[model samples]
Target: MSLTYTYFKMRKGFGRQPMFCMVKPEMVDNIMPDEAEQKKYCLRNPVNQESQAVLSQSQQEINTTRVVLTDTGINHLEGGWPKDIHFDDEETTSRYRRRIERDESYVDAIMHLTPKFEHYIDQNNAINMYDLFYKNMPSEDPVEKPIIRINNVFRDRQCRPTSSIGWTCEEDSKLVVSYCDKVFPINTPSRNTDLVGYLWNVELPSSPVDEFLPPVACWQVVCSPVSAPILLGGLEDGRVCIFDLRSGNSPQDISPEHIAHRDPVSALLYINSRLNNEFFSASTDGVCMWWDVRNISKPTEAMIMSVFSPIVNEYDLANAQPITTLQFDKAFPTRFLCGTDTGLVVNVNRKGKSHNEVMSAVFKAHYGPVKALHRNPSISKMFITCGDWRVNVWSDEIISTPIIPGQPQKYQINDVIWAPHRASSYMSVSADGRLRYWDFLRKYREPIVISRLSQHPLLKIKAHDNGQMIAVGDKKGVMYLVQLSDILVYSGNKDKPRMIQTYERETRREHLLETKIKEIRLKLTKTEDVGVEAPPIDEITEDFTSVESEYKRIVDEEVRNMGPGRTLSSSQLEKVKQEVRKR
Candidate 1:
């Protein structure tokens, strides 16, 4: 019979227990013989005599400190080292040099001729295990043991690895809400250093401009998609800011667009559209305003997804309660899901349509507020998150009852994040500083509690694409990174899935001068032969020059169009000069 063992970390104030990794005997076998020896060394080398006696007594009870193998251990077998251990000259020399230099090597060697070195050692007579074992046993085939990588936070950032925290905005604009004023690539990992990313300050306009703000409350650190730089952030007062990250210098004095909510705008999600360069803004106002970033002066359309609560019979849309969380289905960009202070999750499409039930089924999913909702990045029909005190998964197909029907109301889920690089797996952070992982496909009896460190009320959690690592932050502004294997010996299979290779055109930035020259040479070689009469070199050069010049002209035109003052109309010189003066 095999046993499954796990190491769980418990933090203070957590009402739920999280399971850690499951280990089996086979997985234990992967542990290096040296590691097992070290464990024995640690246990035997008690600091005091009393502990030493306890360790001695415990060692005799177990035949082997070997791990048990089970089905769960099979999963830990991935990525282990190959068998047949071989060490190079320097490594082998370094390992054996100390013992070889000692003349005691021979006296110790003969001690192996006897039945027990342990017997001599117990009597305070000096002898080594290797010397004793070698005389009785012959050398066996060297087995390469698994190397375990432990999980720990490692950073190369020079900045106080945890300081420099705040919202991030773009560096190019002053309006703070100008079409170009937004941070494009949010949460980008550092390539050269361990410092992950930096933050930017957004300056707001001074006054409220009717459901909009001049710049004051309208100023926000716009968070948008990576590809298109559209802003989606609510301001300090009660307005939402929308900026097109792709905006060029179109002498168009376009007012930075804003959406007003009767209550302060709490949650915002920047949504992409199939329509050309169009985007929309959703606010706690219970109204989602759709705008074509091409012209942000006004909303192209607006839809109110919430109305008065039928049970309470009051206009809830314009009340003080605001939206707490928002999310978009990556697969279904046009459809959005929102959670409000009223414990309601509303799913709406771009065309202002909901499910057939109209004001869809509202569930009392949480006793308190729903902090976050995440739709699976790789899957469209499923979503999961934490609210009140429970973590739950939802699928459009299975909606009859709650998964954990009677989770206590005292549990408060502080944050939820989908694993960056995996599917059907997610992690949640709680008010108690607990980080737990849930595999939707597994039994919900208990989740894999990866780690638990004392943390403040967790305000945010972010994962990379692979789910192998995660970054979490708390209200006190402390951030922590959870790496899957800082030190783990992958004892599993090594054959990884072959990645699909797709054809990609090389960009100028990716092409070196030598590469370009070689490509041109290849083109010329294909066009001419040594035996045949070659085309006139002058004619060829002239044709190439003309093509190059035409290409440059096209590029110049495109660049000029991107300049702010280049698009001014001939009849609008006064307008242009006035705009210039204002700038």
Candidate 2:
């Protein structure tokens, strides 16, 4: 609303040009209202506000324990075993050695073992038993390299290769491992053997603290992020099972065999959820199932793993992708990633109506099946993939190529994982029996530390929550606990910013390349279309008057240049003459 005011003035000096006349009704006032507002009132008294958190609260005391480290040693004589024997005197030492060598028991043992040793020596002579396996493997750079020291080694008595290794939830002092025979066309004995998984504590290095029993050979195992005792396992027979240490050895809950995956289960993971009951499983049957532990008889949600192809115009069973690995980031609850046997990374949404709708994007991650997939804890935008002979680091914003497509190693990479504490550091185990540690902040181009850990391939690796230790399992049924140097375990100051910037720059470059590729594709399409059709043709025959006049003008100019005072070049004169003869 707007308003105007006016006033009236009395006449003054009417006889002449009076100033008092100006006081009469100088202005009029007008007002109009356009809009109005008022405070809203709620009639209900003390309306309740609902919250997502728990309503009940309780307090409890915590048990505290002190840790003490002790060192002890045993002293022994170097050469002589008997207390009466003295090895300082050469005469006495030689006399005792001669006496032992001449003993009847020692002579008999040597004669009996000589033939067995001769057989092994002859077999070795027939063929070179030991040869360099990791030929053409690049040596690690020596500057600022971290040392990997073996702290302890735990051997399995049953001689079963480790299939999966997982650390205790948010704790570094313990880990859980599942063992199974990885041989193809499984033998009757191997398949029928006792299926057992172990929960090991660092303090009890001699033996496992607990054991797990699955229905069949277990392929993958994972510890729940929210619960310490809750463990998830995916078996070779395509069943999902969970074990609780507080319970008995048998699985507390298991999926029904008929309703479960028709093929071997390949991947299993526990999602970050409030109830700690939700977990995901993937199988070679191209099916992914979501479950709630409270009611695991049937999956709460399920979907086929397939990508829509424009050529097919619909989802087809032939185009289904067999998921090899599954990774879920806690920060992104609605989305997850799947690695397929064809070397593709499928990014999918959980809350979708169908298989085609669930898939949002796909990345050509590797040439062979992806073995290990994990997102960096510090920078979620970057994720690492290990497969074939390569380990690639990818960015969420780029798809055409990986931001860090590392140099392909000589041997196949079995598993790779990021450090729990360091943002820019990661470790990878390969078939070459070597552990390669990389720190982007220290050396981004090449791995700084490379230590040979085993003669057999290291199958799986899992980091301790403290980041200083890692548990590596091999095909030989032995697990090596490695302690990493501080530089390889701790995050450098202000590392997140640098890592983010590096990824952003790489993403920008990829975007530019993508645009150029689109432009080139458009141009090729237009050119192909033009090429498909025949060139245009004129209906009417045209006269050659203009062409003839142009040729005459050129001949006249060439003749003038050949006058007595001037001469044309021999080549030019010959060309003019030739044209004249043709005309």
Candidate 3:
């Protein structure tokens, strides 16, 4: 039979045959059936009817196919499929050329046109607001430049090994370094050179003048602010040697009548900037002693820590906790902090009636001995503690937990100090010989800068008052002088500096108010069983609530004043306000 006759016969029988017959060549057609015809056929076929019944049992599946034509494709079709469109790839160009040579359509489609009114509308003439803004807006101006070049390195007298723990830069730019057998002062040169001439050198003092005097190591040293020439050195033999720079001679030992501590002095700090005559020292014996420059024989006030509570008179003489570091709150001259070798931080109040009553509170600050304690120069209530394997920031208002906690468990933190210029930034050096710079506001979990100095651990770090330079000293008797970049040293341009300052101030205020609320809540909960009505307590609670409300109002107003583009939406602002009120 002819092919046309066979194809016609197959088409006629295709609807009556099984669904599999649809795949046959004779049954397949270029054109699909209309929707009405398809629906009629589906209703008649038993298999199609079963599928419909199953679909009815559940929700019908909607199959959707959408085709979108790009402007390039539309233009190609409108411009008679030009060769420029095919130049995108060599293979595509060859394929298009072959198709055109053979007179075949590059794309196939069946058009069902609905007649409508045609108008001349240019599709490529649309305007973009971003383009207009880019053309009209002014560019941002640069910030003030910073000085980041390392000015000089002083590495003379390698034979005289220096201790990282005991060194300080004087106002005249002189460096006072303490070594094993003696304490010396070196005059820093203005230009870069290795020759550091000694201004003075004092032999460390020891008593009982024996052949074996333990080599008289100087553990720590500090200069008197009021008397710049006077230097105090903490010795290995539990004695503090006082040296007068003007004498240009050896240091004088404290008289036996004035000697106070019975163990090695690990830390020394001037109590107040105004009171140059008064200073505090912490020894391995766990006693923080406050001494006067005139009378070093006995401490006027002492804070003693013991393993037992309610320490008796005999306990003070027998048992003493080893104190590692000492720091005084700049804003509160009478209050000071002491870190102990047993991982405790004791907050001492010198104004207490008796020496035994000086310790106001004690906190378990670290898992190991607390190595250093540094108070934030800008914020009196906040301080940082470094020890064994962690570093943490604490607020005096709340001593139960740290505000910013550390996470490194492998490496011990040796030294930590707050940035002299920036309120929210600080730096720390770890036992792994890495120095890390942190910005609390930006990243809480990781440091902003991490630098590997050497294999030897960094034991001391100090920042200059000008905020441009920093000095890091390691265990190998090497000191590195680093200069900070402009962004890290100065608060950036006008807008950013103001925003950062405002953020820091507001955050501190919020934390203080929240601490107050916690105190009130604790008092309220604790007093429920007392059956005593305290009107003053109620009034204080009301005042705290009002203050908190005012704080939130101010924060909201500041956000709004920053302008609409910078501020949060009304709903978000309200949510923040509610959260603050709840706190």
Candidate 4:
């Protein structure tokens, strides 16, 4: 399939240079024109005079096979023209293919097939795209016009999320949970069928829960082992709140039976969901504390103290290093792993005489900083996602290397998650925006399943237990729930990755409105501090009226795309897919 890239100037220039960027293949076409032709091209002194004069000098000039490489000659040569280089020798030797294929690391593998394109080219497809006249040198004409830029784009069928429930599960699920700008519904079709029955949101804000102050952050509900209900919640004022799923819903803050850390909770995991008291919480303050609900507010044990490096500590001890991930063993409740910005992986044993004690194995996991860590559910020795685009597997019995015995590459590892219910397999999202599934028991150089959904930079990924579906959320506030089979069969087989289906939602506009309202409320609250300047009640009323009008317009546009008929069926689905494929 061909990939078409629609370039938009986002922020215009970077360092006085064009901010050139590429869109993911799934967003456009991916096929390149394979035109094999031979031609001799030459650079011209003056772009306007000599070239025009020669062309008009005689009728034979019209049919002359010649190219004028103007000041843009530098770009033309660099772009991809048969100048100074022999096309016959290059193509025959497959030099281009060899250079791209040599990148065998995980990061290079995903980008290997990404179509290469030039930003600008002359009308004759010879001169540089950025050429302009400047003191006989070249004027930096930011606008690279009269450029023949051909993008290798191909059309494919549009895809859809397979879940019966909508992308966000907004059907009957009333409340939306937001973490770091990503929103996930508490009620999931695979886990809970009953909309109201799921205990996910009970702790956040319900009727009875209202008795207690609303939780500063939304509560995340997780299924213990199988069907047991457990709440891994964050509270306002940076506190971790663990709630008993059995606790009935009513907006009330049931103080946590165990207070584990002194920071806003970011992630929570139940060591053995079957066991009510066993759980762990990761905090923004870089504290990974273990707890038993029966215990006191303070943690009984903790792993890896949150401390700043010497340089940082010298200036400020309050803002220590931050913790990113903390996960417990899938089968063993006592064994666990924690990751941090410091890029160190601390393997620990909770059963030790002291709580949250690290095991002998602690090592640097990533090139830059570690972003995510997940232990495979099926294999004890195997886990995935350390940092840069690499995945590592470790065993108690270390060999020559601490990492998995395989070739490693550079790629931003944003998310590493075990395949739903499958420990032998795992799914990960890289900085390149590619989603790949791997099996430790299998070969390392190539992923068992690779997806080229590089358009949106995926920040989070969630897979269903059955392995039939996967959901990815990009940095752009767009969430995608894709059928696993579609990605595997489509991108894997055809060497092409296209969106099976997509639904995008953004809260920026709503957030802006909320910010305005909050500002007004703040002004009212601090009226005395502002010298009692009312600016006239009529003016205030007019300002509010204009705001309301703008709000209505924005809402109407968003609502149009999210109408009752927004629902799409198989017929309409295939039709849309065919349309996208044609383009």
> Number of the top candidate by TM-score?
2
Shift in Å, residue 576, candidate 3 = 32
TM-score of each: 0.43, 0.64, 0.54, 0.42
Q: What is the Å distance of residue 560 in model 4 from its true position?
A: 76
Order the candidates by TM-score, highest first.
2, 3, 1, 4
Please tell me which model should have the higher TM-score, number 1 or number 4.
1
Candidate 3 lDDT tens digits, 4-59: 64333556765765555345457555876688866665343445433344534556
lDDT of each: 0.48, 0.82, 0.65, 0.49
Tens digit of per-residue lDDT, candidate 2, span 1-583: 6598887866763456635534556457776654453235436777898787867889999888978889999797684456776767778778888999999999999999999999999998987758776778987644454789999888888878889898886544477888887643334444638688898887677999899889888888888877788888888878888888887888998888998887778898888787777888998678888988888899987767767543222434466788889999999999998999889998888776655557767899999998889999988878999999999999877877998888888899999999888778889999988999987777878888998989999999998778888999998778989999876777656787787787788888889999999999998799888887534444222335555676678867877866857666779867876785576
- Badly placed stretches (over 4 Å) of model 1 are 1-223, 226-232, 242-259, 274-279, 307-321, 350-361, 404-406, 409-411, 440-443, 486-583
- lDDT of each residue in 1-583, candidate 1, tens digit only: 7598877766765677777997774643454357666666534454554334453443345477889777653445333322432334457555565555566867677677564766766766554544555577765644553121223332212322122112223343211121111122225522222212222221222331112112333322344334334444454344544544355211122333344544444455556555444555554556665656566667677656653433222334544334666677557655677677666665555543333334444444565666678876655555665677677655544443343332443447777777654454567776776676654334344664445654555545665433444556544434555556421112122211110010011122224544777799887787676555667899999987876666555546655776855654555545444544454
TM-score of 3: 0.54
Number of backbone clashes in candidate 1: 37
- Backbone clashes in each candidate structure, one number apiece? 37, 6, 2, 34
